[model samples]
Target: MDPQLQHSVAESVATVVISHPEKRNAMTAAMWRALPPLLGELADDPAVRVLVLTGEGGTFCAGADISTLRGSPQEAQGLAVRAEEALAAFPKPTLAAIGGHCVGGGAQLAAACDLRFAEEGALFGVTPAKLGIVYPSSSTRRLVSLVGPATAKYLLFSGELIDAERALRTGLVDEVLPAGGLGKRVAEFARVLVSRSQLTQAAAKEFADGRTDRDAHWAAQARASGDTAEGVAAFLERRQPRFGWSVPTSG
Candidate 1:
């Protein structure tokens, strides 16, 4: 059976699962093609506060399915880059809930996300060296920005997997959880995100993602949104803040 990208939503968080556990959830070409539209749908939804990417089975993605990897190299690479960019550019927060092996393209995907959480025993690698292919520049830069150039070279040059503790030490993953704790921690963090003002979060995400010149616009947006006033009122009233802001629908 072909691999699939499946998704579901609950309590303002959307979960996108990479489902091909027969090959340890390796993504097929079709799965690469499926990502952007699925992510766009979620990005356009007002109710979705955050997105979590994970695998269907115990293991996270084991990278691209080599057996089914047949297509024009340019087309295949283009599709993969497009999918990665979509995930990276998603307006809301994105997190990767990793377990087991997350290698090659899977590592690229995780790097595209804003944060990563992995189980203690999970393994991570960037394996273009093993396959005799060049890693994409964007992904390379993202990895470098996360882990620094030295560690990025260490991962890409060797193509050897590192355990979760090492991954955390190198800044590849934000949090490392015990075997059964990942899901709960991710859910809790997602809920915390859901409770924040979208206006504040979205602006902060944009700035952090390299938008260098939106000062006036962001200030105007914040003033008009009233999120600060509501937040202050809630603090003074000793009540939970109810933020009504949502991302604007993409045209």
Candidate 2:
């Protein structure tokens, strides 16, 4: 089938599947351009409490389709950076459910997500060096933050693929599932995310991403939101808290 991004929402979880199986789900230029707007729609949807990004079939993205680079590598890279930034900025919790190869631009997208769960045999790499192209600074810093300077340098400098075990050891992946188990685990975790307090998740996402200026704003929100009270009451009453707070919509 043609390259595309297929998405659906169920039980407050939005799953975006990258489809380009012929090329191991390599993202084309148009696919990169399409990602941000799609994410914007999902971010604005009240029903979407979480997002899971994964590839169609067994493999995650192999990277950008190299043929798309013939016109202008810079433009292609720019689209990728924009897509990556959009994923990073998505308001709700975002998870990458990875399997097979997650390389080059694929790794960039995975790193942008809040968490990554990879299958046992999944392989990951950041491959700009292999093509003599410079990886974007923001991507580089994000990679360093996830895996530290030395490990990031090793991946960047060598363009070598690492297995899921190594990736988990280096903090590149939050969990490594056995083959055939990724989907079940991701769905289970996503349900847990959906059941939590959105007010807390949104604020924590921003803070974890290094935004310290929202202290007063989050404090005001917390005071106004009834989530804390509900949580306390639920604890005392021996029941699950029904959190009603959601991320504020932008005008």
Top candidate, metric lDDT: 2
For candidate 2, the C-alpha RMSD (Å) to the true structure equals 0.6
* lDDT for position 171 in model 2: 100
After superposition, which runs of candidate 1 have C-alpha atoms over 4 Å from their true positions?
none
**Could you tell me which residue pairs clash in candidate 1?**
none
How do the residues 98-131 of candidate 1 rate in per-residue lDDT, one tens digit apiece?
A: 9999998899899999999999899999998987
lDDT of 2 by residue, 1-251 (tens): 67999999999999999999999999999999999999999999999999999999899999999999999999999999999999999999999999999999999999999999999999999999999999999999999999999999999999999999999999999999988999999999999998889999999999999998999999999899989999999999999998878987764
Of candidate 2, the 10-residue stretch with the lowest lDDT total is: 242-251
Please give the distance, in angstroms, between residue 145's alpha carbon in candidate 1 and its true position after superposition: 0.4
In order of appearance, the predictions have TM-scores of: 0.97, 0.99
In angstroms, how far off is 129's CA in candidate 1? Answer: 0.5
